[model samples]
Target chain A: MTMTATTDRTLPDPADRRAAAHAFIAGQARWRWPEAVFWLVAAASLVIFPHSLVLAAQVLIAGLFALSLDLILGLGGIVSLGHAAFFGLGAYTAGLLAAHGWNEPLTGLVAAGLVAGLVGFATSFIVVRLKGIALLMVTMGVALLLHEVAQKAHAITGGDDGLQGISMAPILGLFSFDLYGRTAFIYTLAVVFACFLVARRLYNSPFGLALKGMRENGRRVPAIGGSIRRHSALIYTIAAVMAGIAGGLLAQTTEFVSVEVLGFQRSAEVLIMLVLGGAGLLYGGFVGAAVFLVARQILSGIDQTYWFFWLGLMLVLVVLFARNGLLGGAKALLARWRRA
Target chain B: MLLSLANILFNGVAYGMLLFLIAVGLSVTMGLMGFANLAHGAFAMLGGYVTATLMAKAGWPFFATLPAAFVLVALASLVLERALYRRLYRAGELDQVLLTIGVVFMAVAGATFVWGPSQAPIRVPAYLTGTVAIGPFDWGVYRLFLIAMGALVTLALIVGLERTRFGAMIRAAVDNPRMATGLGINVDRVFSITFMLGSGLAGLGGALGVNLIGLDPSFPIKYLVYFLIVVAVGGLGSIKGSLIAAIVLGVCDVAGKYYLPDTGAFIIYVIMVSLLLWRPLGLFGRR
Candidate 1:
């Protein structure tokens, strides 16, 4: 880490600049190793833990969902408890296309992303100016509007029964989504890895740095020539696309879409999952979605009625003790142990 | 068509009054404490539930049960403040949002467990049941009662918040807690009192609102967003603002249901979004 930091400032202008470059490089190095390890482990798990492929696939989708949330909540300083607006919109778009005989999964996914992104762009104009609870409330109003439309309009959306008939033909007309869950799992995993790559690149980019600064001090960001509204709008749109892609993935795998996708609970669940894993940390989304989904699964299997109670308890605990989430908490403990 | 308009206005006023009752507390909590009380609607639900159970199941009279409902809901909120909300007082926006959301979830789930998923039907006394005919118009007596109650509360609250020492102290605390603390005001005590008062109003709204919307397990969750929108539009922590905004939203929403049936619910959201665009600080809210 020290060597990388020194080399990062081989052509620095000042001492502080040199130190910042070194720190940046060291942070990059730290991120790279774990990223590589996660990919390797992810590949190995596919081969070794094939029975859990379905669970892993769902985690990948949900992780992407959580990542979309982290972009706004973690980086952009926008706390939205109703992110499912884009997620559900994308799902419905994909589902509608598939039900209408669109067989190409990639095409459906892209279309879903575009449609949700467009909606996000339209709504972001209204949402960008407001801060704190007002922003949260506006986003929720948008989601609720979409939900009401979906529920009441039976002809198009099939209402509460949901648009059911959906079928993805194959990937590149090659791999079939067989009953064994292999094709579906691999497909989702690949999408998640691609999204992860893009997200990481974006985080380390100038845009991402500016967002971090904006979160820390909004006034300072603009003083340095950054348009806060533009940055917020841009990041919100990107997050919406990511959320849309996650929604498309859900449609491809589950082949079912419901109005509940746009509900406040869906948004709240994502927020909980994102916070639980750790926000701002890139891989925190994955950790949070995995732990939260698994816990919910196990608890539901034991008794479906008490799942909310347990989930609520976990949320409260995460807020009180694990402020940075599970990974951050674990990292802190590790650092303490090493110091000892 | 005339009847439909009348019906819309009637429903709108009734709906707005209940909304004001439920949301006034939320606005105060949000404005004063800077905490989002997502569980505010749940208190309203609890009030309805308690009132319904007492009247329908436990054989209690309407007059006695009404006050009892406020006391019960207020007590629950006080307990909540002491144990959970107080700890969350200084937390970040996300923490408050998530924690309050957790409270909302638990409240809904707990209510479900206790009351079951079935809708509970509640009614007012026979004396307050029939409609009052005005010219060619006949309106539900209960709805008129709700309107009267809202107007009375508005008048009382306006006088209380703007004129009284307690109101001045509360306002001072809201504007600047540190300054109020420095001035030797008991901020904590003030916070507790405000929370209880807000929660009691929500409870009252819930009890009165039961006749119109009935009691359902998901009512809190469904109406949570609606209440928030009203609070946002009215400006945070302004009782008069909440009253005006609630009535406007209630009227527009109900009218839309009759006039633009196809886009009924969406109309309200559209209006909210437009209003937000026009005045991000809300109609009466100051920066």
Candidate 2:
């Protein structure tokens, strides 16, 4: 036993090194069984209800939008009521590009993301300094400013009538956007999946951990040698890019854009959707968007006049009872059930 | 150009008075309670609707309906504070925002259901209508009345908050709730009364502002940003600050709308953003 111990101390075990490497990779990937199941369900839904692809695509786009908000509000501890600024900026950029003859989907999407990211980067210096209501005001102010600009710049934005004649080219120069929205759904799903993978990787990264730390105690982060401002600005820019991509997807799919994209109501609705699904968790955005859109569809169909009343009541109740949101509530129930 | 400038100044001051009336309560509640109530405008809308309905349907005079509007909206706000807002005193700002926004949505929908989603027509008394020549300028009697009311209310608020025994209790409660409670002050009662006063003032402002700002189902959402700007720029709890900020905003808005009609609200927003960036704590706010 002494000889074995001496040998172990003198020479590092190859098996132990292999196990450590495997553990590092696993930590990096962090893919759970449930995540795989979620992807499977998403794919199965696409196949099961081909006719509802348009609605599904919209839900996915909203999910991406909400996800972008979640990164700032949930993970980075930055509450913004104007994430629609990025989304609207992206939509207008893509819409204008398509209208002016750069109709290629991928190129437009990239341009949209880059433009939104640049704006976010520029504004983050101002935005990240404020907390609580001040932050909310500045973000809302930015969006309101953008909305006004869009409304006045009628030559490019089409004013209140909306940007028309945005004809998108085929995906990969092969599959065309169809009337039934089959290609749109597949294209959106692919983008969402790609973005989700990147987000998942980000959430598990060292930078992400630092953000979580900042959220909990911002002062402590700097004490621990983390650059809170840089991380926050970077995350804000990334989230903006994601939101831009979502907006670009929406514009491309619908082939139109409007001033309403930058409206306060849209920003409020996205915030509501993010809170409804859950925040903090990466999948919360997707779940919230799905639930909110579906619920809205059903509620409006039932009684258009009183749909807002119900929505309002639901929001109040959610804030009162389920502060952590629906996904968090569901997770708690599951945990309790397992313990039982 | 001189006449136009004078006209702008008069109109701006009148509009600013209306904003001060609406936003002073918001500033007080936010500073004292540390609660971000986005539904303050909803109460103002309620007051406006009530006054309009009473004037139109019940054949009440505009002056008579103002008191009724104040009392009714104050009572409504009281019930809401006791039942809902009281529970959320310790909740996070986000939750407060969500709850208040929900209230706003409900209020807007309710207003739409009752008022038919159109602007409620407000008819001022014959005496209050039309322009009266004063010195080199002709001012609307209603605008003059608004300015007078605004001045009286500001004086009353300053006296009440700074001089009265109840005001002392309120100040104590706001500065140190636990200490106030320990010293035998009924903090809850003070809070409730303060809330009622704020809401009552908001209602009065709404009734007064119907002609200038318009009254409709979308009134709350339409003027929410304006009210917030006033409160933010005025330094949350300072009535004097709100008064100044509201007047400045009113002037800027009136001037911007007249001079740069094509640009819409672009200039006002630029001013607000720049002001906020420059003085995040507000012009008169203390750390």
Candidate 3:
């Protein structure tokens, strides 16, 4: 009687699946208005203000960079100050490959991602062992060591003079990279969209949920029989691949690479961009990159040196007041305004 | 071969002494307060820049500007601690790292705005400029001066930290802050003082280091990782560990550059990794 009762409950799954799908669709429909409006505004801004496209491209790259950071940092609770290691590695790889007679842009880009992923995988073993500030210092040390090697290796990397001559054959050989950066912008935007979709999928996956649990309480995760090291290492590797792709895009578009690609500044800037965008939130990175790149461009144009003071004040203010970055704060403020 | 070895030894000791001066504070801060301050190097840069500008441009004497460098960096550290760092002490390490990063950005920008992007040569006095010979060894008097000054400071600091009441409190706090606080030691005051003291040393290092290393806007960043490694390798929270590690790192780096230029940085990492493998925590650091 008990076996028959259990079988009867288990066998009625096809109708149940349809009902669950309907509920999910209904829930999504409820949130679609706000999501649509946000994207519509983002799209309109890119069209109305053509210059915003350049900013958008930067935001796209920055988002990818920050997304990589968030996977390890926000999800796995690993604080890395040297994420630029992977980004720069990818960039240098792409640039080097393109410079040395590899005409296929996509192939070079994929190579860049693969190389960065390998480095990330190797480094994750070292990184996962350390915790807190010690982890940060060691990771940063790795990046600095790499940076030093890059700087001192004059023959291969072109030293401080920078590696300049990278020629990427047209994307799929049909679309030429134009002078106005239109093709580059669209290409980056497409890449960013694809990455975002994948990141979204991952975040909703079981592994991602397990990582979230680990971040909340590492000890608790172990009690539940989860291997925190393996999860953290895997996420770190994935993030590296994302950062590498971002770097590849950068290398391809800029057609130049330098030792500066791996400098502390690059690392620091990515961190800032991440914080400036709301970390853990999917789109916060893009918002942050846009705000920061635009602010930087405008401020530097006015007076290059004074821009730091502004950035410093902004960072302090953001930390103290906004805390959630520009978009997060703006959303809250708008909500309050509407309520008022 | 002997002369080259000696030369390497001399250069290593000198460089290590400078690293020690900068790193000692990082060790203290990281060990004592658990604060990961990336901007400490910025304080050093500030000291170098201030000393350079005052000594070179404002025509201040070495003796006069040396104290001024200490005072300025100390004040800056105190202000930073009070204004920003206090809020960050309880925040996660990532926040602290990022906040300091912001400060570094500001400092770099400010330095660039004020001094342009050129490397400013900070000249020592004529009396301290030339070399001094000891038997077969010829050493720059200024380098020797730096070593002597560093040793003196290290001695004084060791005595202060080990012998004084403040030292006892600091030790107690480092060992068990809760017990120290329960015993009526002002932990907050200790944290501020420790930060100031550490940063003061960094300033001193910067000012003194400029004679050898020169001053640049990116100077802080170049030494930031090195200083952190010293603090980390020496074991967090112990002044003696920092001192020993700094000197060891300094000598090793100098020797490596001379003996194995291709693998100098690798050697330093090897040492650090090996040390960690042996001690896990650090040389003098307790788990």
Candidate 4:
């Protein structure tokens, strides 16, 4: 009698829960109009702003880099100070490939992603255990170590002078890179869009929800049958692969790689971009990259020597006034306006 | 071979002392207060610039510049603490990091504007220059001075923190802020003073460093990793741990470079990872 009663009550719960989960995932994955607008704007930029394709290509690369960071930062709530380690590795991977005569662009990217992913998998074990200041220092230490290694292996990495004479094969043997940057822009946009699709899908999945659950409450995640370390480490490695591809894109587009690619400043700059655009939001990376690149271009134009002053001021003001960053703040305002 | 080993040992100790001096203050604030104050390096940079400007522009001797660096950076820290950092004491880690990074950027630009982008040269008095013969080996006079200064500062800090009534109050506040307040201690004032004191020490370290590391706009970022490493390995809020940690790291780093020649930089980082994995709280940190 007791077993029958328990079965009657609990049987519907699992089915109901599963259905609810499916509905939630579907709702999140459902195509939003703004996402369409976003792609439309990107496509139109190729035509509307053809002269600025080079900058647009750079912007897309930065966006992709930031997006990769968001995978860990937004979902896992893991703050990494050494993301540039992967970026630089990817760049070097692509650079070396081209330098050694395997200049095919598409294959070069795959190799870059694989190499970075391998390193990420190795380091993720160490990264997943630490938190707060310890996490920050360790990540910084890892990057600095890589930076040191690269400098010492100058014979292979070009040392202080940076790798020279890197050129890439045309896209699918059809579109060659031109000085006007049309090929670069289209190529970069296509790659970033594909990555975005993956990120969007992953963010709406049950696995991503589990990672988010751990971020909200680590203890609760365990109770819900999730392994905190495994989720964190896997997400970290995935992000590293994405970051690697971004770096590869940069190397291919620029046709060069410098020792500065793996620098502490580069890591800090990317983190700043992510936070400035409101980290944790899927589209925040794109907005942050656009703002940062534009700001960099405009500020440098105003005065090369003191542009940093204005950027610093902007950062301070943003932190003080808008704690959640530009996108978060804007969304809050929209919410408030609608209620009123 | 023996002479070279000794030489390496001496150089390593000197470098380690400099690292200790630069990081000890950060160790205290970060360890005890639980603040991620990365801009501590900026204060150190300010101190270096101050020393450089005084020596270059006004022709002050090295000794005179040191005190000025300490007092000035301390005052500047006080201003920043009161106006900016005070608001973020309870904020998230990201807020603290971004705010400090902003400060570093501003400081770098400010230094560049005032001092230009070149490395600022420092001239130590002749007495602090040249080598002195000690037991069949010539030891660098400047390096010997650095060791002496490092030891003196350590002794002073140890005595000040362990013996003084102010130290007790500071310790109490860090241990239990609410309880310290209930005990009639002004916790705010204590933290402010401690923070200023830490900044002043960093400034002193920076002024002292000018002769060794040289002063530049990139000073903060250039040595940021080394400082952070010392604190991380040393354990927060423990002077003895920092001393031991700094000495070990300094020796390893210098010796690795000397022997390995090519892959010298790899050793210290390896040591750090191994140590932290074994003991995440560092050499003396509490849970």
Which candidate gets the maximum lDDT versus the true structure? Answer: 2
Query: How many residue pairs clash in each candidate at the backbone level?
Result: 0, 1, 1, 0
Question: What is the per-residue lDDT of model 3 for residues A1-340, given as tens digits with 9 covering 90 to 100?
Answer: 9999998887767888778766764553343466567556666655776865766676778778888887887678888878888999999999999888895778888998999999999988877888865677667767777787887777888867988678878999989887767778888877767877777667766687789899988899989999999998899999999999999888888788898888878888887887888777666777778788889999989987788778877877777777777778877899999999
Candidate 1 stretches greater than 4 Å from native: A1-23, A26-33, A47-49
Clashing pairs for model 4 are none
How large is the i-RMS for each model, in angstroms? 1.5, 0.9, 2.6, 1.5
> Model 1, range A37-77, lDDT digits (tens) per residue?
87788777779888888888888899999999999888998
Docking class of 1: medium
List, residue by residue over B1-287, the lDDT tens digit for candidate 2.
99999999999999999999988999888888888999999999999988999989999989899999899999999999987899999988888999999999889888888888778998988999899998988998989999999999999999999999999998999889999999999998998899999999999999999988899888889999999889877787888889999999999999989998889888877877888888886776654
- Calculate DockQ per candidate and list them: 0.63, 0.68, 0.44, 0.66
Q: Which 10 consecutive positions of candidate 1 chain B have the poorest summed lDDT? A: B278-287
* Deviating ranges (above 4 Å) for candidate 4: A1-12
Please state how well chain A of candidate 2 matches the true chain A, as a TM-score.
0.92
TM-score of each: 0.94, 0.95, 0.90, 0.96
List clashing residue pairs in candidate 3. Answer: B31-B237
C-alpha lDDT (0 to 100) for residue A110 of candidate 1: 94
Mind sharing the TM-score for model 4?
0.96
Residue B189 displacement in candidate 3 (angstroms): 1.7
lDDT by residue (B66-132, candidate 1, tens digit) is 7888999999999999998899888888898888777777777787789987888777889789888
Fnat, one value per model: 0.51, 0.62, 0.42, 0.62
Select the stronger candidate by TM-score from 1 and 4: 4
Give Cα-based local distance difference scores for all models.
0.86, 0.90, 0.82, 0.89
